[model samples]
Target: MKRLLLLGVLLAVSSTAHAIVIRHDVDDAKYRVPATEFPALVDMPGEGHGALIAPQWVLTAAHTLPMHGDLKQVVINGAARDVERVVVHPGYRTLPQTLIDQAMASGEAMLIVVFLASGDDVALIRLKAPVTDVAPVAIYSGTDEAGQIAKILGKGATGTGATGHSPSGPNRTELRRAFNTITSAYDRWLCYVFDEPPQALPLEGVLGNGDSGGPVLIERDGQWLLAGQGAWKVVQGNVLTARPGRYGQVTCNVRVNHYRDWIERIMAEPAQTTAVG
Candidate 1:
């Protein structure tokens, strides 16, 4: 019996995948984001994605922002805050054309130039007035060791072939649950939710458009730590069921473990680059 229990735990650990399903590019929504939660999301000028991880810092995808409003302001929940800094990952290429090429080639290892969901993609921000209300998420960088269960939260869109802007609605980050196994874990890797129970998220319930730049958490014991950020999700055209539509990929939260130093270094730098090169 003891051996069986041990084996079960091992099996559980062995089967945990970490690929995130993130989406971008879409019109307005049919439904409304939660009221309590609505205050946390700030709208970027050019229309990318936004999520409040801490009272001060907003998390988001690097490539979403336009050069204009990089990281200028932050509206928490509803109240707006003036931007003080911008931080992009050092490794992220500033040019959009280059980023496009990289994405087309391997579909792995995205070097996002962090733009503060506002003026510039900010990895972290120092608020003008310290906000002690919402707790800041802890980021893990040293070990995304293969075979670890990772949890994620985001604001994915709804609606199927409802492809046009008219067919969707704003789905806020209510801390949804999606699990997968670690297929390959390197600088950047993939995870499969199929191996886990609840094979896939419902067609409309899965993380789609607004979910970009969210967190994929890794729960150890009773606590949760930030592991990956919502990146991409596969969508199918004229689809009835939820499937990884061809050319559609469930990509989110690039796992940041094994790079604790990078996070620390970025946090320590003058909010300059969004991605860590």
Candidate 2:
């Protein structure tokens, strides 16, 4: 199948992708964080990522899973855990790649917007056994995400705002964390922009290739809460001029608060007779 390249809809690929695109002036090492700092962050089937929200439940993007197959395992805290079942949101839907490509090629902004709004791109994975070593992260229930500083963690493609996503692709072994302020908050999405040098944060950055389903966190009191999950990017120009993770680019993540009830409902139910792939 052809990869869904537009809207930053990352699919599983064999090549290693890079992570966070930082400011041109900032040292790349500053964004490198230890695994212990985010133990709940787990590796999904491919380059995608998910967070442990409950002992045996993982929250991730619905698009990250295969359209027709079983998800056998997910790596949590460096260990593989058996996946008992996968539950995709009832509202979730997959658009044809040809339609997405045609819209981008024609610069049909309206079509792009309609396609993005068509589904709730969220999912949950129930593990066969609970992970005792890692502490699960909490979901942010508040609606005031705008103006808040968010810490984005991923092991995807890396580059600078001046140059956009690297031609070198991803560095899978290096996990990085970067900060960005939420520019806007919608009912289903939390948006952030990649600011230029003088206005950017110390380690300011945005998502690149392979970051789908990764976590976007906001601190409340002293604890970090999961506010969003990396889903797609809204570029300002046509397909020819578009550069993923470049300056002024906006990333729209799946708002966790909006789907809190759905997550709760899925986790509350007993094991399903069949898993949704």
Candidate 3:
């Protein structure tokens, strides 16, 4: 089964945060790295969504895994490349229990059963070869707040906008997703329309399927930073019996600040990560 992810912090979320169309826990195994960065990430068969971060790294969604294993590839000219290693946020959990407790502690606890926050969805692919093409987007030292306007790019929902079965015998898809990813999900979930500006912020556009793992970037004082990772959408279905129709709502991106210590700790041991075989 595919894994899932999301974001909501503060030990517990406010009750109002629960009512939007939230993102479910679909595996972001489709995180595609560029050849210049590393070989194509495994599990992701085709042109998966990716963005350059540095000369030797590419960032992608954490769940983009392989049917058989977990080693993100680097792609170039439609050919698979090679890689040195990968560094994912240590906080990432295939089934994170702490995150679940946080979810349950809040009125939005169900968000945990389905997915975690978007804040930790990022995965960095370190390449044996350095990429000179696409430049890495800055990994912000800070995350954006509720009303900041940000841009997101990624492949969107598939199969006529409804779910379908993969035909690649569980290894790949006979019908690959057209990764024409676009705008980030707007404030429909995090904040209401009237909530925009002055102090409270809101999403500027719409978000949908295929946008998972996309970057939410915001420029503060003319400086760019990685604000959030697109996680899940809240769709009130049979599971949410109280609500009949899926409303406009979103999950969350876990705070980047929450994982700074973890990331720094891992990066401090670069040799160990590079030695992964």
Question: How do the residues 1-277 of candidate 2 rate in per-residue lDDT, one tens digit apiece?
Answer: 2123423432211111457778988888888888887999988766778899999999998767765678899999999999998898988877667765675567544555566666798899999999999999999989999999999998888788997774335435478999999999988888889999798887899877667788999999999999999887765656444556779878888899999988998899988757653
| Residue 186 lDDT (model 3) | 31
Cα lDDT of candidate 1 equals 0.39
Q: How would the candidate models be sorted by TM-score, starting from the highest?
A: 2, 1, 3
In the range 100-209, model 1's lDDT, one tens digit per residue, is 34533544212321221112222444455544555555665445446666544444433322222111224333333344444445554333332311333231223344
Q: TM-score for all predictions?
A: 0.56, 0.91, 0.54
- lDDT at 136, model 1: 56
As a whole number from 0 to 100, the lDDT of residue 118 in candidate 3 is 32
Error of 1 at 126 (Å): 3.9
Instruction: Count steric clashes of candidate 3.
Output: 49
Give the candidate order by descending lDDT. 2, 1, 3
Query: Can you tell me which runs of candidate 3 are displaced by over 4 Å?
Result: 3-50, 76-81, 96-122, 158-204, 221-224, 239-247, 272-277
Tell me the lDDT of candidate 2: 0.78
